[model samples]
Target: MARVSQEHLDARRRQILDGAAVCFARNGFHATSMQDVLKEVDLSAGAVYRYFSGKDALIAAIVGEVLDQVHEGFEEGARSTPPPPPDALLASVLSRVLATKESVTVDGRPAFPRLIVQVWTETLRNDELAAVLREGYGVVQRTWARIVEAYQDAGMMRPDVTPDHVARTMMASAMGFLAQQALFGPAPVEVLRDGLRGLMSVPDRGAGSQSG
Candidate 1:
């Protein structure tokens, strides 16, 4: 048999992943099956199985792609002349995420955002997925911590708090944005950026100031 070129193999893998994404986004994880994926891609069972063993594996691959992209954004930000502020960095991250072709379903609904809600719920019962999620987030957290340190070095952020603490809080906010996007249709990324700015801009009341 003639050997398949690497480019051909890569394209096939992309086809499977993209088709599975549409299926999962439309019907959800539990509702989507390997057979459903095969029908969506119009590929033979053997061909599709060559890439993903089952729906669990497909779901894991999709989630991994999303996390990997988020991680890459932080890596890029770290190398800039000055790293983006937490809010702006997150807004950029979300913009890239929402702009991906795979992020939208055929019906014009957000794909990854909906899948993310399912992934979070799946973590409770899927140990492998839970571990994958924890590992992915840990790497992202470390990347953000380095940015936090840079901010501290420039006196842009307070030195009193640990970098991990700030990183965790920022990540929590990003996750919250995804949750909201998943549940409530798309909102402008600026809303999140501006809201964070508003929170950070609040004037601090001096201890001496009090009601008479």
Candidate 2:
């Protein structure tokens, strides 16, 4: 048999991942069967197994892809010239996330939010998946932390707040907002902006205050 080229292999893998993402999102990790995935990709069981050993492996890949997309969004936000101000950086990150929500569709359905929830729940029950999810979330938190630290160092943030604290708070707020929007409907961007500003804001410490 003629050997399949690397390019062909990668393309096939991407197709499988895309199909698996849609299935996992709609039926969820626990509810979804290998056959459901097979139906999505129109591939044989053996063909699907070639890319992913089983449902767990496929779910892991789908979650990893979602994390990668989020990372890309942050990278795009960071690349803005002169870098965005603290407020702009937060907004930019949120905007990128929203943009991804709008753009990523599968089988005439929006799957990202569902996929995210599935990954979160599954992570609690599965150690390997939990580790991957934790690592991915850590990367996101670190990215925001670095941005917060830069602003703090530059005197843009109130000196009383630590970068790690601000970063964690901001991420928590963003995740909550995302959950609300996914469960309800789209929220006003201004509401998110205000919430983030409030979390990152520092009260003015008078010049006479001792510099810790």
Candidate 3:
């Protein structure tokens, strides 16, 4: 009985988050009222409040869910047995980012990316949301930096540069592309891959040596 109740509770939370995502994606976060979210969920006021304290709480939960999905994809890529070569790892990461499963929709339009943009917009307005965004981005930054370090250690990435530099460049590029795609639905993933291939390429350490 207790276990069943727990399962039902978890499902209800996800339902609320899903409803909130749809609402925020449509109206933008600051403009979206709790009443709007309630309308989206079609649930009793008390029931919804039980899961989230208020609008901020619900938005925080939605942000948490998005960051979790991003982290999961990173973990899945980082799991290649024997570890993937640098190019392979970067390729797989880009492939995973462009995965269609990330797109949730309302009324046939993609909502997830829009929701993320809305969340970012709110982060500047709400201190709590800013903290949450910072924490989540910190996790992502460290994860990518570790992967970059690994590539550098293997001599599969350029030397003379810190892992932070490589990680920041790749992360910034990927995120910028996401923001662009969210607003404009720009070019395919191949364009990004092609662009990054040279930036991430392994430098020949012995290129300047006199080999006679």
Candidate 4:
């Protein structure tokens, strides 16, 4: 038998992952069986199992892949000259996320956001998945903290608040937006940008009083 090229093997693995993502997104994790994934990819059980041990393994890989993208986006921004302001940085990431999810949507509903929400719920019972998520998000958060520190140094953000705290809060806001988008229909990305701008515009009462 001719040896399978590494490129071909990688492509097959990607196919399995993409198919599993769609199935899990269309139907909840519990509802999507391994057979459903095999059917979606039109691959035999042996072929699919060779890539992922089972549904849980697929779920973990899918979630890790998505989170890794998000982490990379933040890392990229940090490398830019004067890195994007917080709002623009976040808006860019959100736009990419929406577009990617929209590409694999089912019945006009984006699969990626839905799958994200499902993963959050799944983490409640699955300690292993929860650990994976925590570590992934933790790295993203650290990157954001570094960005926050830069903002503080440039006087764009207040220096009083801890960078980690600001980063975590920003992450929470972003997650809330995703949950809202998933539960309801899609909203313009402007909504998120405007909201962040409005928050940034708010005066710091402590600073105002001390300066008076």
lDDT tens digits, residue span 56-170, model 4? 9998998888898889888988777567888889988878767765667667677777778889999999999999999999999999999988887778777888999989987
Comparison by TM-score, 1 against 2, better one:
1
lDDT of 1 by residue, 1-212 (tens): 99999999998988998898888767777888888899998999999989889988888898899899999999998877568888899899878877885444757876777778888988998999999999999999999999989888888787877999988998998899889988888788899999998887877676348666
lDDT (tens digit, per residue) of candidate 2 on 51-93: 8999888877877876787677666655553356655565666
Clash pairs for candidate 3: none
The weakest ten consecutive residues by lDDT in model 3 span: 80-89
Clashes of 2: 0
Model 4 alpha-carbon drift over 4 Å, by segment:
205-207, 210-212
Which residue pairs clash in candidate 2?
none
Top model by TM-score, which number?
A: 4
List clash counts for every candidate, in order: 0, 0, 0, 0
- Residues 25-134, model 3: lDDT tens digits: 88887788999988988998999999899988888888887677666666665554334654455556656644633455766766766777788788777999899889
- TM-scores for candidates 1 onward, in order: 0.89, 0.77, 0.80, 0.91
Better of 3 and 4 by lDDT: 4
Give the least accurate 10-residue stretch of model 1, judged by summed lDDT: 101-110
lDDT of 3 at 177: 67
RMSD of each: 2.8, 4.0, 4.3, 2.3
User: Cα miss at 144, model 2 (Å)?
Assistant: 2.1
Between candidates 1 and 3, the one scoring higher on lDDT is 1
